[model samples]
Target chain A: MEERISLSHGSGGKQTNNLINDLFIKYFNNEIISEMNDSAQISLDGSKRIAVTTDSFVVNPIFFNGGDIGKLAVCGTVNDLAMSGAKPLYLTSAFIIEEGFEIEKLEMIVKSMADAAEEAKIQIVAGDTKVVEKGGVDGVFINTSGIGTIYENTNIKAYNAMAGDVVIVNGTLGDHGMTIMCQRSGIDIEGELKSDCAPLNSLVDSMLEVCSDIHVLRDATRGGVAAVLNEIAEMSKVSIELDESSIPISEEVKGSCELLGLDPLYIANEGKLCCFVSEAYANQVLEAMKKHSLGANAAIIGRVIEQVPQKVYLKTIIGGKRIVDMPSGQQLPRIC
Target chain B: MEERISLSHGSGGKQTNNLINDLFIKYFNNEIISEMNDSAQISLDGSKRIAVTTDSFVVNPIFFNGGDIGKLAVCGTVNDLAMSGAKPLYLTSAFIIEEGFEIEKLEMIVKSMADAAEEAKIQIVAGDTKVVEKGGVDGVFINTSGIGTIYENTNIKAYNAMAGDVVIVNGTLGDHGMTIMCQRSGIDIEGELKSDCAPLNSLVDSMLEVCSDIHVLRDATRGGVAAVLNEIAEMSKVSIELDESSIPISEEVKGSCELLGLDPLYIANEGKLCCFVSEAYANQVLEAMKKHSLGANAAIIGRVIEQVPQKVYLKTIIGGKRIVDMPSGQQLPRIC
Candidate 1:
């Protein structure tokens, strides 16, 4: 590890994993965190199970094309719990605001959080506010911690991927990362490019109705689909093969990535998730997902394989095979 | 409200209350948050109740006299949960680090956090880390959210104070605020002065054993005992009378405050808590508190009165009385 913290340490890629494992886990070692799931599953009174997750949103632009920091804060944590097959019930929000920030803007962000919590059917029950002197922080940063109840007979985990499982993505990728990148760099695109930052608990509930035993469920946010796929592959010790033609990508995001010399596979998405389930239940889960408004573009883009264990391979439309490696450093900082 | 947020908005005094009520509670309006206890008490499965709380630490000079930001972050949230008469079970930590911050320093912070969590007997089950560009933030900030199971048959709240109840403080006051203020201003006090930052869950447990129905248990942080007493007075619709001579203030803290022309009442103490209990159990509670190391200097400082409802009065050593009004603005910022 480097002597000084770098932007890549928070990239949600290889460096982020190194920091979390080498520093955080080394000291705060415990069985629950050792599992390395999106949320930590704990049993209360040794019977009732609950999922807990926390995230701090430092998106550079407090407000963006489609959503603000507040909405992203709630949805990010809510989605983490949902990925663990939990029904998010309560959320606690804490804000660290820079001095001289506009009060009205703060109100707007709080209102957005309230509205997002309403959409997710969770309540923001406890909160704290801290104000620092000018320049102590960026405009403002919000941290949200969510509590959720795990569903019965449901065990969704990253290491649950099996050899005969199929990989499904709910929507197109790179919309969120590309939109923020363009907005920050003053890039004016001709097509629609807005963030896909919405709570996915309802969509997750719909898919679980079809099959409660989904093998792996993960949201591709900071490091994109490629990162999540590589993680699942390593954790489950199973190789994965992706079909490039089947992977969903929006036209605007594709154009933006091409123009900016970036890969859609490495770009971030907020309202997207990758699901792995047995091949027998793949179509049923996809059909259930497509019926929801947020999952209209759901597609089965990959499948688990036994060859070359713990690796992800991309099958190109040109009939070529390439390795999809975990990102080494950050491409976009504070994208989510 | 001011057009822009001032340091006072986070002072945990009058302005902080206004910001919370006018903005946060107005938008994030719910029955749980409206209770406005240190931690929100909610029932899980409509039977087993739990307490949840969140706090962000932005104290200047991360390393202070007796504790660092890491220890402060854990103790702050743990104390909040304990104040609600709950057994803290888990905590989630989120860090927002600035680019180029020292990794070694971060490790020390993490180690301190681990030690504090171990002392509180709580597991840090989930965490998130985010890094921003250099100058985007001061070195780093931490937000900790705690979850604790509410003890059965216990209902501690701010509005539970009765007219005959007595106010007791666990230990000396203003050590935390004065320590930070002196360190920032380069003041050298002759006597010992350091933050009393420690997890009080065990101490609270001891008191609960003596009387489960203890009323208005609160840690005197940010705005100190004066602010907390005023809040309880307003909430319970009763007057509180404090004997100036009985209030315990360390010799160092008293000298520092006098030298700096600051009032000890408005200063913060991280490890101190104010307890309100009926006169019947006050002696028993005090005896139990004194048995604990953290409460060796415990003293009964005041009592609730029907006169001057919704106010706090201080009785001087010379038999004079004065109003301990809720501070309007911040005397010290980022003292937590």
Candidate 2:
């Protein structure tokens, strides 16, 4: 059995090939990868078009409750392209591995990335590997670049959220961040806390089928809902008013946040998306999102309006109005 | 002065903006990067182009010539695309920094990446950072991913080498490897050998103007000349014969190799290239190479053939044919 990765694994020889086949290919079996060429050649149908997006995942621990860094890396990039109303296609992965990291762990991460790609209906077309001396590198940092086919002439961007567009979320917030924090800090919650890492491209596809004119689609990560709102408001040059009662939040995540002195809105989410759609099409998008396992807790939480401030404001249940600012610092560093 | 990177540098807040503006923007000061946008959108002209070839640099100590990680990362990827005859456009960098490393050292590395991007006329469009706990990581490791635009009509691949093709190296070999080895092993071979890390896209532009039909361009990197020859023979299914006497080697590198029990051929090069061209235009290509500063020692070392064995054979000074094979395993790790 392979105990760990020796320096020879990155030497571009038989060891590299063997490792890729035994671990990576076994889990990430796909048509493009089967060739094992330098770079995967993706044949695109001109009529269909293409979209490209790249994202890097440096989540703290390689493995966590519901997923691992590999799964998060694949899902993250796929979702970025999917948000542009694109049908995800090919993906390229780059890995920075610290010396002395267990080869088994890397294999696990690779497997997870492959599995995520399969679930998202995308191919891991190309990849690169770099090894850093021990102490100079982190365990593993992953970057993924994806190219996808856009479905027709769909136009979706951060600035697409118009005045009167309704804001909707696919699921509860803070589950991914809280799960990791609890695990890393040895904090026990009243209930089991699991990260929500998952691929949301299919759910995006489904929603786009119904609400083809959806104003915006964004994954709630890093700075979470608050940051997403800030970006959208700035891009659209419009203000957004959010209803605290309408935003979905599970009691478990809320409790965990309170215990840790963290704001759920500022925390990260892996399996969720925050979408803004025209009021007329909001219900259809919500229904489509609800059909997917990733977006079952979907809810409409806010509306956009023409305003000079182009800011986001939250309306508490007690009739208090306050600005919802983007998180000042990373709420969860190393979050995918 | 702050000696190390604090949490502020990555906070995406004031410090992050400052770092971008002060150091990165100052050196890398390009219009695209200056905008500080998430991605760069570039306009390209339609032309017949295939990314074309080489790089060879010696990292001293066999590493640490200048950039143990960051600059090396940038030059490595940029040079690869240059070898492919592609116009490099975007890059992704990954870092492995050892724990307890002076924050200043890490910042310097990052700055080196920024500077290399500027000099190579590429963009640091994407990046990743990871920190391995002390002893778990090394001083630093960098992996760079570069994307270049391929000119639509230029078709170039290793398998395209023809039997009547003439081979030429951009410059002399073993200088980079020898320089690094001498420095690392405490050999004072005419002062610590300085690496030849450099970008070759400019040199390629000059050569392509004259000989765009050059069959194959390969960078002589790890495993050096022997490895590249093996690849060409297998890819084109053609026999290759090299005259040992025609190949160029520096006296310093030869001396260092002899003293250290190493083969100059097996050592890594960071800033040189190997080119295969049609014999009819070989002399023209040689003249073009001679005009460039980096190709002072350019030499026609070998040629392709239709021999049945389809192997790379080197004719020794005594007229004996010996086999040249790919490296069996890691000759030197972390050379990048």
Interface RMSD of each: 0.6, 16.5
lDDT (Cα, tens digit) per residue for candidate 1, span B108-156: 9999999999999999999999999999999999999999999988889
DockQ of each: 0.90, 0.07
Off by over 4 Å in 2: A1-51, A134-138, A149-154, A188-191, A235-237, A305-311, B1-70, B92-143, B182-187, B305-311, B317-321
Give the TM-score of candidate 2 (chain A).
0.84
Per-residue lDDT of model 1, residues A216-301, tens digit only: 99999998998999999989999999999999998999898889999899998899999999999999999999999999999999
Deviation (Å) of B84 in candidate 2: 3.0
The positional error of residue B256 in candidate 1, measured at the CA in angstroms, is 0.7
Docking outcome class, model 1: high
